[model samples]
Target: MTTVADLAELVRAPAALSVPGDVVAGATAARALGPRTAALAGASVLLYWAGMAANDWADRRLDAVERPERPIPSGRVAPATAVGLAAGLTAAGLGLAAAAGGRRATAVALPLAAAIWGYDLTAKNTAAGPAVMAACRGLDVLLGATGGRVARAVPAALTVAAHTWTVTALSRREVTGADAALPLRTLAGTVLVAVAATASRQRDVTAALPVALAGWYVARYGGAQARVVAEPTAGRVRAAVGAGITGLPALQGALTARAGAGLLGLAVAAAAPLGRRLARKVSPT
Candidate 1:
């Protein structure tokens, strides 16, 4: 029997916690917050977990050499089992989306699922890897906008996709050290994202919370990238990747706030620190 610990490792469970906020931010930005939002969030988590499992399954051979401690390579979980889990979770995610929001949500979910598989099986090692993964996240945000205001959610989708691009680009170097320029460039990108997020809101009572959350996101995530620039070791790169993954909720929260959902944004922002704390116990990257 595969233990829950093994399953958790196989699915990168801690990182899934970062996913729901993506849908929340997107839906809020689109002004589509409805009873369906909860179901869409659940679908997002399922799809994320499915992607993680598929990634491990596809990388099992390479991981056996370079990451023998991983669940599949270490024999804690079988490759077949991981594939099955990925397929099952993908199906569940689509079903949940269909059940919650009908055909429109299912349409988005279909492409999102295809992107997850494509990234894991085909595009993961290519130059297009980061871009494809970013698309998956962007589509995830769009999935929440199935309520028909997808055009209004484009900015939020782009914002989340940009953040994901930086993280995915850096994740490729988690094992091998990266060029100092890589993290430096990503740090610069992070700054621009912060500026954009904060600038969206005028100085007002509502603006304060979003601005503060965006500041916190940049401070923590950008600090890690800066450290990687100073020392482009594999360890520092890993740390930076971890921070990017866990700190994303704050960025999402800022966007949610800009969408005029300040209380919901604050709730979303609170997940960042909690995700960071959980990461100490289970690596997000």
Candidate 2:
């Protein structure tokens, strides 16, 4: 019988801490932050967990060779159970979106779900893997903007997507050690993402919080990637991936602050250290 721990590991429960900020950032940008925002963030978490479960299901065979200790490979969770959980979570996520934001949220969520499954089943090993994964996160941000001006959320979505692109690109090297070029390129991308997050036309005191959060994000995630550049081993690469996962809340908070939600952004940024602490136990990657 599969234990709760098995299920948690299968879905990467700790990593879901990075997901709600996507919704919060989007809603703040679109001026849609309200009661429904929490529900939509919940929906994003469900979809993210669904994607993680589906990823394990799809990679069960490969994982047997490369990751024998994984839930599916170790026989802690059956393949059927993982796929079923994935489908159920996907359905639940869409239903929650429909309930929270009606047709508008569902409309965006449908594509987001498709993108998630598409990335797991078909796109993960291809050259387009990072882009497809990034699209899922971008769409997730849009899902939270259904109640307001979605167009206003585009820059935030793109910023989140760009950061996700770097993470996903580096994730591909988790099992197989990469050359120095890979981490070097991703480190450069991380710097660009931080700059984009900090850039503001107003350039007043309002930008201070976002700038500080962006700096925090770069220091944590970029610092890990920098280590990988020095020694591109599988262990260092995995550590970098974990850092990217846990460091995402700072990026999200930066985007939220840039959208004029300073206190809420700070609240969102608080998840970073908590996520890092939890990751030590559960392994975010």
Candidate 3:
């Protein structure tokens, strides 16, 4: 029988830590932070968990050969169970979005859910995989802005999408490993993402927090990618992907701070270390 721990692993529960920040950053940019923000964030987390479960279900065959210890292949969780959980979570996520932000949030969430399913079922192995995954994350950010001017959240959404692009690109190599050039290119992208996160029209003390958080994001994720550039082994590549997953909150926090929510951004950034710690046990990738 499947236990809660089996379901948690199937969903990569700890990795959900990186998700709430997307909503927070978008809400900050759109000036929509309020009680509803929490509900939207919760909705985002459910969608994220749905995606993870769907990914495992879709990859069950590949995982049997390459990663048999996974919940489905290992017999800890049945394939039907995984797929059922994914479907239920997806429905719950959409319902929650409708409740939290009415039709507006549901509009963004519908596409986000479709994109998540598409990436796992169809796009994950194609050349457009990274872009598809990135689009899902971008839409997630927009979901949080439904209560305010969504146009104001576009830049932050794009910034987070760029970061997701790099992470998705690296994730493709986590199992097969990659040539040094791939890590090199992703490292370059990470640097550009950090710069974009730190960009501001007014250079003042307000800029300091975002800059620091971005630096932290780059250091943690970039350092792992650098190691992959050195070896490009499957183990090293997996490590880099894991780093990208856990380090994402820092980038999200930086985007939130750049949008002028310093203290809340710091709270979001705090998730990075906690995610890293939990990753040791749960394996976020």
Candidate 4:
């Protein structure tokens, strides 16, 4: 029963900690320049949901191929309805971004929408998919940073973005058992870990270790997926889980200064079990 309704749950997928993380990261960065970041943080969540809905709508076809049971293709949700929903989400997100940072912040909203559309329509098929995916995460973070300290935060966002890119690729053919999914996921994780090791000068090891462990498990498990995706919905939700793993380090990093960070770590550490429960509850089939 993890029908198209289940796939539609993705409307809230990107809105979770990923959006919160971006808002916090952006506001923290922008605050360096002396701005009230609370308002910015609030708007970011709206934008995140909007962006995700647009992405889901754009990728309806690809999802249909990889996930025939999804809303748009499964007859549970109309394609036209999904498109209209995406448009509404986009408009709302743009308005929120505009209100949050005026023209500078609002400016990125359109690009973000374009990027989401582009990725759905074609990026996943091109070699540039990885780069574009990575860059997209970085750009979203930048949108948040516009409120406080833009320059200082860009590097960290870029760091996180690189990891995100790898996860995106991993969730693709590699994690979906696309014949070459294993090697691709391995290489992507390896490159990301290697980059982190070199850039953070071993400090990232503590965080990198868990990700490495996850990658190893991914390598071992091949492309087994979440049970919630109707028929074989694994591919659609596979990449969705990447957020929890890649975010582990930054959460750890945040722990050094804030108790909230430690709590985040706890949340991420429990993501697998939680996701399992969610998958089962949503997909009950």
What lDDT tens digits, residue by residue, belong to model 1 across residues 1-285?
789999998898988878998899889978899899999999999999999999999999999998899999999999899999999999999999999989999989999999999999999999999999999999998998888689888888888899999999999999999999999989988998887777663667877877888999999999999999999999999999999999999998998988899999989888998998888877787
Off by over 4 Å in 4: 1-15, 32-43, 174-285
Please, what is the TM-score per model? 0.98, 0.99, 0.99, 0.66
lDDT of 4 at 200: 33
Q: What is every candidate's alpha-carbon RMSD to the true fold?
A: 1.0, 0.7, 0.7, 6.5
- Cα error, residue 217 of model 4, in Å, equals 14
Backbone clash pairs for candidate 1 read: none
Error of 2 at 125 (Å): 0.5
The lDDT for every candidate, in the order shown, is 0.91, 0.95, 0.95, 0.51
**Model 4 C-alpha lDDT per residue in residues 143-168, reported as the tens digit of each score:** 76675557856665665576566556
Span of 10 residues, lowest total lDDT, candidate 2:
195-204
lDDT of 4: 0.51
lDDT of 4 at 98: 79
**Clashes within 3 Å, all models in order:** 0, 0, 0, 7
Where is model 3 poorest over a 10-residue stretch in terms of lDDT?
196-205
User: By TM-score, is 1 or 3 better?
Assistant: 3
lDDT of 3 by residue, 1-285 (tens): 899998999999999999999999999999999999999999999999999999999999999999999999999999999999999999999999999999999899999999999999999999999999999999999999999999999998898898899989988888889999999999999999999988888588999999999999999999999999999999999999999989999999999999989999999999999999999889998
